[model samples]
Target: MNHRNPILFEVEKTLYPTVYTLWVYPDLLPAFSTWPPVLQKLAGGADLMLPGVAVPPSGLPGVERGALCAVTLLGNRAPVAVGVATMSTEEMLAAGMKGKGFAVLHTYLDHLWEYGDKSYPPTLAPLVPDPAGKESAGHEEEQEGKEPVTSSSPDPVKHVAISDLSLKETDSCAELMGKEELHESRAAEPAEDASPEEQQEAEDTRTPQEQMDALFNQCFFHALKCKVKKSELPLLTSTFLRSHMFSCCPAGQQLDIKKSSYKKFSKFLQCMQQQKILQVKELNKGVESIVEVDWKHPDIKAFAVPEGFSSASAAQDSKSEDREQVYHAPEIIPLYGVSTKMVPLFQESGHRKGSVLSSSEVRNIIINYVKANELVDETNKNFVKVNPILCDCLLDKSEQDEISHLKWDELLSRCLERLQPLHQVTFFGQEPVVRKGNIEPIDITLAQRSSNKKVTIIKNLELYGLDPQCVANILQQKVQASATISPTPGAKDRVQVQIQGNQIHHLAKMLLEEYQLPRKYIQGLEKAPKLGRKK
Candidate 1:
């Protein structure tokens, strides 16, 4: 017997060593610039540590967890090593710049680099300002009056530029302190205290472009930290601008990016990318997408939204969400209402003329009233003696028998019959609504019409405060059937919905699930055909 097999890309073989001819395209992954000694350690198969990595002043490049990244010497843009990030850029900073930073897989001196053409990293210009140079210059000034430190023993933290990690936060704190001091100084000066008009004039002194730029930056950072999420990433730039950033602007203040100094959306994105707020890439030709975001940036964390800004947008979102869900009427139950004639008997039980009670409740109240008044006959336990309230409520004038007593069943029946009909509709999360009228059960009937065709007819929906036309539209959409609404025959100002075929299954789901109507209130459910049975 002969067997046939096939192989995919030859690149898979060298993947374990992280070396291939594919490395020719150096910009394949996000590059993190660090010192040469750190690259040497990685070459020896040691994992990169956060303390050893040199972060530029602009900040670390935005990278997600486990994403492929390149490592380069601080002065050179050429990557000499390849690895996957152990965590996102924000997480690395959150760790206080301590712990493993990258899982190094390939380096210049590793076996993989030897397998390919053995070439050394080229001497290239640094893409960012060297933090070590600035630190050394500052350290010299601090030690001027103190002991003179020799250049032979330099601080390792200063050499590796680890101080850059805290630079952004320190600068932000200084800026805030500066603002506070300025306010205090103004308050201390008697002539500097200004009126509202003066403050307005001072604000108006700023150019329009400067004001627009400040507003643009505020909304951008606000949207990134508050409104946007990692899960919603790879979002289109246009959507981020309009749906998120624009909506976050103050209600009366419009956000026109064109008015800003950057003048173009692409320019703004490029500036943010340089600051490491986010990573924007062109997924498709000429279309930019935000692939990753740095949620823990110091600027984003420090930005506080102005009070009441975007309040209208937030409220509108909640209202729109509520509107999306259909409001289902409550389950309605019939009960007896206390008419003017029946008020006297129920009044002693704390029921007024408009009070409504169920049959059992009314029976219990009447029994209690009889027991409290000692109206039960002494001779027969089954008969209740008539009181003036009972005579006025239960006995009619046409019956002049002047009946002094009545049987227990007769008395209860007369009370219930004489009481006015009422219905109480109870909705979830709301109070029950009681109205004085009869509520007909929603009637659903399945019958054969022309040519033995089946039709489902629904009636009495309006009696429960439901519109037949609305119900018909919902049922038609749900069942994918033809539905028509017409005036109910022999009924005044009432309508009925008629749907093609026996749609009882869909109607049951709509009524029980969507409308939340009780099963007892919907009539003719048994008429629906049983499931999984042939006709």
Candidate 2:
């Protein structure tokens, strides 16, 4: 048996150089000059101090020298021949640490500072030497074997003062660290105001058209539901029926219908049709329901005709009988209650020639009579002539008293005399020649002048041409005067029916009440009746 195996190999590679950040306070700038030449160049320029520091000559009032300046390196790596210190250039030179001497001390400080107080020499004093003084060989050797000076001392007074100074420096460093950290954190946080994404989401939540469509669909569903529940027949017909039903429902009930949700009435009708609950023939039936029959059909009579008498011929006979009975005896009273009579006035001539008064003619006569009465009062002169026979029949006892007070004879004579010339005068037609002792040639041309007779008459009287207004005036007078009338029986059993002023007023009142209309609405009703059967 042959076996095949896969081969694998391990590989290693060098990593890229990492960058580091360094912080330098104003007091620590002089210490950086002590770094090795290569490291000093890597530190960049002197103007670049740490973020929380002010430059030397402008140092913050309470800041001290030899304070710790932050330096961030890659992982645990430290720069060669460099150390962290906080001191100005003037302070470093005064302490006799400059040039080559400062560079050596800086390297030693880096090594010893890492071990903190443990790396300090056992025997040392906290004091600087004068740069001008020369060192003795024996003293220099003795100092070399002793430990370096530290901020703390064994003496109680010196130790207490040094401890207090250390605490004050620590607090100042902490404050500066806190301010830098706070500034960085604030820069990284997001703005407090709303973002574009949030605004867009709010707008996308519900578009205007979507909201409108939802509202419309809800209303449609509610209307369909109401139609389905109340209808007895299939849904197809229910939609039409619902509209009529909704109108009948009170306004409050309509709101309730809107809130209801149910399947569309049309859907219900489709279901019913599928189930054969209603046939196509039934759907095609006319507006009336199946239980009700057409009343206009000849076979249907008397609302509930006998079952056996449902023939068309029998229904026709029933209808004829019904029509005949409609003419009852009370409606057929003889005109003037006369059976028959002979007229003596027409006996001498083949026919009577006196003009018979038409209804309109009678109305005109009554209107003229009222006008004449009004003019008589205003002008203080008699203007109307009343026939004694007709006056006696028309006036009641009280009306006679009112007429007597009106100076009946003089008023009648004046009115008749003034009207005599007008009665004989024909307008735009034949003019009657008045036989007089000496009269100018009859002015036929003048009499036939081209002018609207009605307009001319109205203008002459200074009155409106509207007939209704005139009629209203006459009616109002009759109401106030309370005129009445009576008629005598004649040989023809026909009495002269003179309508009194009060009777005219009663007719006007009836017209107003019965039709809820003014007299102007029936302007043509007061006319002559033809000699024939009533329409």
Candidate 3:
């Protein structure tokens, strides 16, 4: 808790045995320079706006959304506030640096700082970006390599004291500092002095997919080194991806398995296991778990945390970490498309053939059309008089009884039947996938093999966004039976999982209870062996 000029402190929680914010050095986190006014606003509980951020000649540090960051006033290296980034570096540029940027958590004049000697932040002149701004990329790289030493040197930072300056002089000095910082931020790109071949060699030679794969491996190793504990072995792979690896990913980068050469995350883990970095085992059919991590592996020991990627203070707040992690099953919502016969019926509602609408939306349109046409039966109230649109869509050709009316429930059912059935599947943190035709429910069937051995065959899990292999792993582990997944007959792209013995009950329970899927969306539950009437 040494709070002298450099302000050394540690943030911890009684609930957490270990401190969540681990900064071996005070300047480890990325720092953004701002004006004294912005610091005042931040100390008064205002978020740091992008417009208020004073960028140095080197430009803003690369940081991802949720990364911990610090804020300092112009011409001063001493940070006056600490916060998390509200958006990534690229996002700020994309937005033209207008909206909110950093979410301030602590400030110099706040209660936390009050606990110390209440010392005012010492003035240490900020690094002056080269005025000529003609430094080559190689020189810039070299300077960056020396950034750690320069940043730490500011501690007990030797600089002229500003106490003697009058109010007008101080303001003038701040203005000059602001101009220098802006010039540095807008400095021109360095010239390339290398030959074409040399330039090519200097640039990353890997393909986009290869780079992403390497990033995944880097984040995985980093997570194993700094985040995962030996006691947390047998960690669920899905949890590892969503919680640990994602956090370790560097700023301005994303961790999407689909973008990697190894499309499946499981395959990536398997590759790591092959390389002896970690050991992955299927504790259940379709589900893989990391049972062991090679902490002392040469690669792990040699790994270095990438610059500006501080997950410890940046990933999330302490309260967020304390919350329990929960899995969100994919959401499947039914939608309807206007059919040719119903095109005229829904024309007034601006719905054309092939336009999709939710059930409630369709019902509202239908009700509005019916009421406007005064189609509801005057006497019964439950039946609706058939109009030309309804007659065209609801009646069959063979029903020649000259029926002019239908029950309310019957009319709604006929309306839905006449329209095209569609469904949208949405996974967490992903775009919704809209598909034509009815959603195929997960199918489970019991079949007899050549030796009269009963087995369970499951299909169409992909329709609900479930990975077939992962499901197979879970089922295999649950029943302690051999489970295999292969391409479905005549379908090259789709696959089915087959497990030894009739384990339909387990499969149904997983879908119905754990996944919270609607029973109507699950097919062949009747094939499950009856509890009382044993097979």
TM-score (all chains, Cα) for each model: 0.35, 0.12, 0.47
Q: What is the lDDT of residue 336 in candidate 2?
A: 13
Ranking by lDDT: 3, 1, 2
Q: Rate the local accuracy (lDDT) of all candidates.
A: 0.61, 0.26, 0.62
For candidate 1, give the lDDT of residue 259.
Answer: 87
lDDT of 1 by residue, 47-144 (tens): 56665565554678899998767787644555666667888999988976556677665565554444333434433322222434434423332333
Q: Candidate 1: which pairs clash? A: none
Who wins the lDDT comparison? 3
lDDT at residue 442 of model 1 (Cα atoms): 90
lDDT of 3 by residue, 280-317 (tens): 88775556678998876645654444544454533233
Per-candidate alpha-carbon RMSD to the true structure: 23.4, 47.9, 16.2
Which candidate model has the greater lDDT, 2 or 3?
3
* lDDT tens readout by residue for model 2, 360-448: 34335444555644533445544443344224534455666556433545443333222212112111111222222221110101012
Top-down TM-score ranking: 3, 1, 2
Candidate 3 local distance difference test against the native: 0.62
Q: How many collisions between residues are there in candidate 1?
A: 0
